[model samples]
Target: MKKVKRRAMSVLAIILCLMIGVSVFTYRFFSQGSQWVNFTANKHIYSNGVLIGGAIYDRDGNPLVHTVDGVRKYSDNESVRCATMHIVGDKKSNIATSLQKVYADELMGYNTINGTYSVSGTGNSVYTTLDADICAAAYEQLKGKKGTICIYNYKTGEVICLVSTPTYDPENPPVISADDDNYDGVYINRALSSRFTPGSVYKLVTAAAAIDNIDDIFEQTFTCHKTEVINGQKIICSGTHYEENFEKSLNNSCNIAFGNISRQLGWNTTAEYAQKLGITTAHELSGIPVVKGSIATSGGDNELSWTGIGQNTDLVNPFAMMRVVGIIANHGMCVEPYLVEKVTNSSGFRTQLPPNKTEKRYLSQSTADTLSDMMRSNVRNKYGESNYPAGMEFCAKTGTAELDGSQVSHSWFVGFSRNEKYPYAFVSFVQNGGSGAKVAGVAVTRVMTAVKEKVDSQSTAN
Candidate 1:
């Protein structure tokens, strides 16, 4: 009787073990095969391996913006022009996904054996130093206008908010068949994809180059009376101004003074300074297909003169401008800007992104400090007392770029917040808009205020 009881118990234990083994096998087989495809393979392809340059979230892990799927409708008939047009890019997900399909396996993990294939996503998450509240605020303020707003972390080289007007939905993106390259057919990611004349904003580069190359730039004053002749070509300023110092040249966006300074530095020096600021070939390192802007060195003295004041085919994108400001904020170090904060695996293992290769000493510490001070002065002294923020030490540079025949100018503002923390930095542009101070300044302030409000609220809670 005892032997029979022991045998029965052993049989029950064997049955249970077999059942467990079968369950394990089934799970693995399904998970590694069809189940994986069902779970991972995109039900709707947005863009092949293009990935639309992954959307970014703030440090607090809130999503500020994303691509729109073609499935929905986006409307813009408000005070703000259309922030989505630039930052959110276009509704090319379907075409992007289709084009990426060929490269998908190469970029993403796949399960393949015995004539079967399954694809899994890249499984990476982008962490940006941008505060979400700030991005939304900027977008909210610039909704009806053709504009752009960019924010970054100067210390980390992380972009906070990149808002461009005239946005589109990424998920239900608009359909684009073959041979569609016109700007109207697609949404341009103006922040990185579209290039514009830097206008007054280009002066930042001119200032840095002049200070770096020319001796006694502070003491030198360039005489200006509305227009000046360079290489026998007439160039005019927005206003008829007299002799001015470097500080005033920047504050008033004086073309004649900047043009003279550029003439002194020459084209070679201007190009070199731009390259150092990560404006030239540095786009490749940003992990996006950047539209290269031209600083026409071949245009001789006249071209150089115009380029100095951000005219005559000197092109740049909003995000790139933000990076240039970031270098100034970081006191000369310019890091390769990135969006992905971290990556995680299916097993719940977290991995930090590869460290950004930071190129140090793009500008001398003194040069950066000087530039920052000048930017601050421009904001405080020139923008008028009413526009200035009461409490913050906002260092900024405003730009107004003239496009050949266009009546309105593209407005731009790039700046860093707070004297104490230097916590965040950003750039904003309003397309075919007014002056940088009147339009871009208000947008930047709104975004900064929103970001501060959110941060302060969180601090109070903690």
Candidate 2:
């Protein structure tokens, strides 16, 4: 009898394990699969005047989209429509970047208990964390450009502004078919999907590795020439820098200095730090799809040197680039970027979304502080302090990322600004643009100025 009881208990445990495995697989399939095309896969349910979903709103409760008279309606503001197309997505579900499709279950107010979503929906609304005004401002600043600009509060992990180009008004979204590249369809979300060469911006990774492994990294000095020859390969920089310390090397954006430093660090430590700083990973921003950053983990001495200076198969997603900068701003600990703030169902049950928390500590607080100081010096010595809003203490790094000889290089600026009132990290990318300082960095001045004014006004009003 005791043996029989033992056998029964073992069978029960096996069944329980199977059930748990099935549950886990189901959850993963839904959440992960929901990211792309699954949300709108059942469009027929919303057809024939059946209310298939709920509304979407900005954090301020400003409505973005809702069903009216059995038809999905978007705001009439063309700028808002164009600026936020990738975030909200159109009703037709043609674009790959449609957030509505990703969150269709919540939008439809699908009830697990009842297993039904009413035609009128449960009035469950998905509140996004986006600020529409900031999106519009970013879009306007990026007019006629092929890049993206993003600003998020690193401490709160609230993405403030996210603007991508090649956008079209949702009200009059054009047809998308084979022969047309998003040049006319306006489907690409450059901020999240596109990857670019980081240029000198990646020096932050090489520098961070050096700091962690090398002794008193700041004390080390390096010499730079117009063209540096290493292993029969010529690495070029903006100009010759006679002798430069860690801070000066960053401020001067010296390629040779950074290349030698990269060689010293080698591919192993550099690759380790890059992964820690999120340079080779796809960031998960729930409902948003960001391409993973790319790098060469192993290479020859000359190849590793160029990789250190932000070249040689090193392609970084713009969002990940901004996030690495944000990690620095947050002193190595950061919150995950969240879009949906809350979800309210038709049953009047409101679920408040928790702040997306980051589980890993990417760097030590001391490392972040040292890198932050170096960035500030870069701003003061290279990018003029006057260029930014007056009295704003900020840090910056400029990247003139090169491409093929046929096209101009990309202009990239990555940095953060913090004060008693505001804590923001930003990245601006301009394709085929001029110098990073003159173009992308200059663009930051007006944007940050506007941000400061708005913050001040809001404070006074409060």
Query: Model 2 clash pairs?
Result: 51-119, 122-346
What TM-score quantifies how close candidate 1 is to the native fold? 0.75
- Residue 32 C-alpha lDDT in model 1: 60
Off by over 4 Å in 2: 1-44, 47-52, 118-123, 175-185, 351-356
- Per-model TM values vs. the true structure: 0.75, 0.87
* Candidate 1 lDDT by residue in tens digits, 227-342: 88878998889987797888988887889999889989988898888787867764742345655667878677778889888889788877778888888877877765655454
Q: Residue 138 CA error for candidate 2 (Å)?
A: 0.4
Candidates' C-alpha lDDT = 0.65, 0.78
Q: Per-residue lDDT tens digits of candidate 2, residues 1-462?
A: 999999999999999999999999788766664333233344544653233467888777777787776677776567777777788886566556666766666776554443344545444688777888777777787777777888888887788778787677778866667676445435767778788888988988888888888886778988887788888889888898988888899899899888888888988888888888887887767766788888888968889998999988899988888888888888888766666777877565674465456545788989888999999888778788877776668888999998878889899998988563768888999877868888888776677777888888898999
**Which candidate number would show the highest TM-score if scored against the true structure?**
2
- The CA-based lDDT of model 1 is what? 0.65
